[model samples]
Every structure is written in structure tokens, then in C-alpha cells.
Target: MSSSTEPLPKLFTPLTAGDIALANRIIMAPLTRNRATHGSDAPNALNVEYYRQRATAGLIISEGTQISQQGQGYIWTPGIYSPAQIEGWKGVTEAVHAEGGKIVAQIWHVGRVSHVSLQPDNRAPVAPSAIVAPTKTYLESGFTAVSQPRELAAEELPGIVADYARAAENARKAGFDGVEIHGANGYLIDQFLKDGTNQREDAYGGSIENRVRFPLAVVDAVANAIGKGRVGIRISPVSPANGISDTDPQAVFGHFVEKLGRRGLAFLHVVEGATGGPRDIAPFDYAALRRAFKGVYIANNGFDRESAIEAVESGRADAVAFGKAFIANPDLVARLERNAPLNALQAETLYGGDARGYTDYPFLTEKAA
Candidate 1:
């Protein structure tokens, strides 16, 4: 179908990414729910129900799943490193697929945005440099400042890249349709991408080329592990989330996106504005960045229905991803189709909880009744 003839309210529009055809363009952005089973860090039945409820999205990107024990920064977050964890994720993927939906796993590593209490053996978090994250990570016990992270040796970079590669392989084993590298939100990849966090003088730091090396390596590794068509990456060029800031946001991210475009990945998901708190401001123009990256662009961050439609209609983005809106509206696609009002998300139950604010959110039909 031609882009012009595609119906505006057709939330189920088909989109083709290399080899895979999506049932719609409404991609579910990866969101951290922090509801994994304690100690086990495995996905539970509630997690399954949570994802299954939102299966109407053309594609569902699972929350940031840790690649290893050391990759976790928050309490009760799920991991893909263990057999039980893989089994747990299998249920989520199977449930989504059972409803004729496609899903991808967003593999993530928190880097220095971690507290000692959340680290393995209560050890320091790891990053390209010894700089501590300027933000705080939330825990059940409350929020705490991030501890100073140990600088990873150059030799250790390969292992970390392998961790992401292995996680992509594991996602395939878990029966996911694809994998999304969480290179955004000041995570491990973002820490390396931004200049403020990466103070190393080695090949991984100093110039923009050097700073983007680790993230590029990760992209190449994961793309190699899974075919390039099955791999995607998420980036926030001007994000200040987790105290991440780059010297020249436009030049650095423009080059980074240009380089990434050459790899022929499935799509590039760009989150505009501050991902976490209000501190990290957007310094670069998003439209300019969209022009630089010559691929399927999924624009995210604080977008409403009108703006989302305008983004697509204006050619600014191929699609728009919703976070909070989808959290409280399982039939989000239907609401958009009917131009109905969305349920406002309750601030209290965003993370670390059960079905109260999760699967219990009534659909538009139920609300009308």
C-alpha cells in the first residue's frame, strides 16, 4: 500500500522492516515496570498478563531486560542471563504471539546509574570511567545517590559487548521477533555515548568518534549475533537523563546516526526530551537529527494523539511511541482510532507493584459501560 493512500485512523497499518512485516505502526516503547520476582529477577505471571493486555500494538518492545547479574541497576528488574529467566520471558513472548502480535526484547545495562545495594555483591557499578552517575536510581527502600563506578579496563569492553550479543541470542531463544539495543536513557551505552560520563583517554573516549565506539561495537555485536534485519537500536541524542551530556550534541549524534545508518539495522528509535527527570535538557533539534538518520525513525517522548499524527503526516517520523498513555490504556490503538480520551496514568503505581495499576486499567469499552 502506498504511504499516501494509507488511512489516517488505521492504527493497524502494515509496516515492513527488512524481512518482517508489522501489523501496525503503533510500536510499544520499552518501559521498565520493575515488577520482577525478588531474588530471582525473573518475569512473573503478572508480567505476562501486563504484556498480553497491550498486545494490540503492532509491535511490543519488552522492558529493558538485563543481560547479566551485573547489568541490573534497579531492584526486582528481570534478566535474560538465567534459564529460569529465559523460561519466564518465554511466557511473555508466547502470550503476545498467541494474540497475533510481534515483540522485541530491549536489552539493557545500567552502567553507573546503580546503587551499591543493587550491584552484585554490593560492589561498585561499572562504566567507561570512574565518574559516578549524577542522578539517583529508585529502589523499594527509597531513592539514593549513585555510587562511584569502577572504570572498566579496555580489555573488558569486549566482554560487555559479548554480554549484549549473548542477550540478543537469548531473546531469539526466547522466541522474540527481534531485539532492540537500549542505547538511550543514560544507560551503559548512553554513558559511553555521552562525553560527561566517559572520561577515558583510550579509544573509547576523547573525540566523538572514540566516544561512540563502544555503542557502535555493541550494535555491531548484536547485529552480528542476530541478523541486522532482526536488530534495532534506541538512542536519545540530547538526553540529559542520568546526568548524561555531550559536548556537541548535533555533531556527535549526527555522525553517530550516520554511522549507524550504514549498518542497515531494522529501525532507529529516538526518544526526545529528558527520559528520567527534568534536569537533562534537549540541546539539539530533533527534526535535524531525523534528517541525518536515513532509516525508519520512531519518535518518542511526551507525544499526544494530535502530535503523533502530525509527526507521521509531516514526515518527521515514521511512527510515534507512547509510554504513559499505553500504561493506562490497553486499547490505546482503538482509542486513537476513535479519537477517544485516554486514561491518565496514576503516578503512584508506575513501578514495583502488582496488577492494581497494571492489567486492572479498564479499556474504553469497559469504561463506557
Candidate 2:
């Protein structure tokens, strides 16, 4: 849109985010495709091919991988707990690395965003409080309402933190470039962070500092297990995904990010407005968040090539993450480079499906032919 005198966008430049070195500024965001091995809940050959096809991305953040059985909220989503699961991921990492791409495991715990059927021993889900999320979880049958979660005891807190630490250790064993703690999207960390969901008088509830305790504990444990440079966390202060809300997102998240900066983590991935929704869904100062985090700032949500370029060249974001765009375009980086048209996304096949929408999207070369 500019004159020929204007400089090219830096979206394709190479840079390093903590320990992980990227080939470009265009990143592949973590997407949940329920295609893992059915019973084992581990990454399989299909996932390996899927990731390998998109290895041209600057960095690939793997789908939300549950840290434990209790962390799982959806079926067929991969986990990083068991030895078999770790072995399954090793193949994925090796394939990505072979293609000169960097990948990080998104260690996750869905917290109260799960149903009873998905829990261990068919028990109720756990959360900071006993509130039921006004959301649904996809099961083998269909999408159903989330179950009522019981309040987790103080003693159980350390075990959950341990699970996060163990997941990071397992990610290292699985040959991942690093691990991204899934602390966003109204999950466990977000549930505890927002006062709308958490209503307790304990040390983990009430004020902003008290609410951030559990999340910080998990971050510290994970960073201890892996180096700080190998760790990053995702946060969505104003996002209302999965029925999450905060009375004061600014004050709570400001304090949270300030504390995170002191830890010297790799990057801070922030979902600007709402998860997969409007960017102006709420009144938020994303620039303030960028200022708070001293490390890399990866901006996500509704970004096109031009905006992505502007974000990087203007220093608003160190990098930009593409979610649905990457799903339909394996060679997304190349397509963007040439200003080529993108493939149409098959929305129906986005979830639990075979290679039709997963890896069957044609490349630019294939389309040209």
C-alpha cells in the first residue's frame, strides 16, 4: 500500500526468543486439532507429518499438551505425562528440527474447563473455587457443558505445581526446543487470576497479589526445571474465552506481568482482545503490556501480513503469531513473502478430523500447477 520508497517489512527477519532461535518473525500459533492417538492420547505419525509440513514457520508452538491426567479437558488431545507420550513427541520434535524449525511444547492444565468424563476415575474437575465455567467441552459424543469443579485444597497446590515442573522436564526429554506454559485462555491460571471465577478467603484469592500466587508458583517451578530462557507463558488479560472475566484486568495483569518480567522468561505471548474474537472486545492497553514485559512480545489475534509487518517494523511486537492462517497454509511464510493468495480454510474439518484439513491443504507450488 505504500510507495516504492518505503522499506520492506521486517516480518521475515530472523531473531532469537530466549533460547529458541527463529527463522522469521512470522510464528505458527498453537492450535488444538483432536487427532492424537485415540486411547494413548499421544502424538502420532499424522501429527508428525502435520508439523513437518509447516516447519518453515519461524517457530511452532505445539497444541495445548496436558501436563497430567487431571489437566486434560478434551479427548484426543496429546499429553506429556507418560513415557509413551514423551516418546511420541520426540518424533515430532526431531521432524521439526530436521527441517530447521524450532518448536516448543505448550504445557497445559485446563483446570475447571473439563467434564467429569475426562477426569481421572471419573472424578470432578478441580479449580481454585467451586464455580462452574459457562462453557462447553468437546467429547466423543458432542460438545457438552463443563462439569462443576470442586475447590482444590491448599495441600494439593504443590502437587499441581510439581506436575508443571515434571511436564517441563519431560518436554526436555522429548527433544523440544523449549516449553510454553499455558497460563491463558481462561484455564487454570486465568481462573485463579480473575476474581469473577475465584471466590475464596485463602492466600490464593481476594487481592491481586494473592490471586497471582499459584500462577507464579507454577512459573517458578517450570523455570527451575528448565532454564528461564527456555520458558515462556501466554496470558490474555481482557479475553473472555471459556467464560472468564476480571473486574480489573489492567491492575491484575499489570502486577502479574511485572512479576513475570523479574523472572527473565523467554517471551510473553498475549492474546490482545478476545481469543479468536474481536480485537476491540474490551478496553485494554496492549501497549502497556508490551512495555511491562522485558522479553520478547508476541502479539496475537486478527493479524494480516501488512499489520504483522507493521507490528514488527514499528517495534510494537517483536513477533506475530498466526493461528487459522497457518492451519490452511503449510508454507504460510513463503506465501506471505510473495504476497500470494492464501488457501481457503475448511472450517468443518478443523477439529477432530483426518488429513483432509490437517495436512491436505495445497502449497503455492501445487496451486500454481
Error of 2 at 73 (Å): 0.3
Query: What is the C-alpha local distance difference test score of candidate 2?
Result: 0.94
How would you encode candidate 1's per-residue C-alpha lDDT over 1-369 as one tens digit per residue? 224575654334678765556887788899888899888998989999999999988788899999998898888889998999999999999999998888999999999888888887999999988988778887888677888899999999999999999999999999899899999988899888788888899999899999989999999999899899988889987777788887787888888898987888888998887774342365567777677666678888878778887777778888778888889999898888777888888989987878899889999889889
Report lDDT per candidate. 0.85, 0.94
Q: How many clashes show up in model 2?
A: 0
Residues 152-263, model 2: lDDT tens digits: 9989999999999999999999999889999899999999999999897999999999999999999999999999999999999999999999999999999999999999
**Candidate 1: where are CA atoms >4 Å away?**
1-6, 9-12, 276-283
Report lDDT (Cα) of residue 304, candidate 2.
Answer: 94
Per-residue error for 18 in candidate 1, Å, reads 3.0
State how far residue 306 of model 1 sits from its true place (Å): 0.7
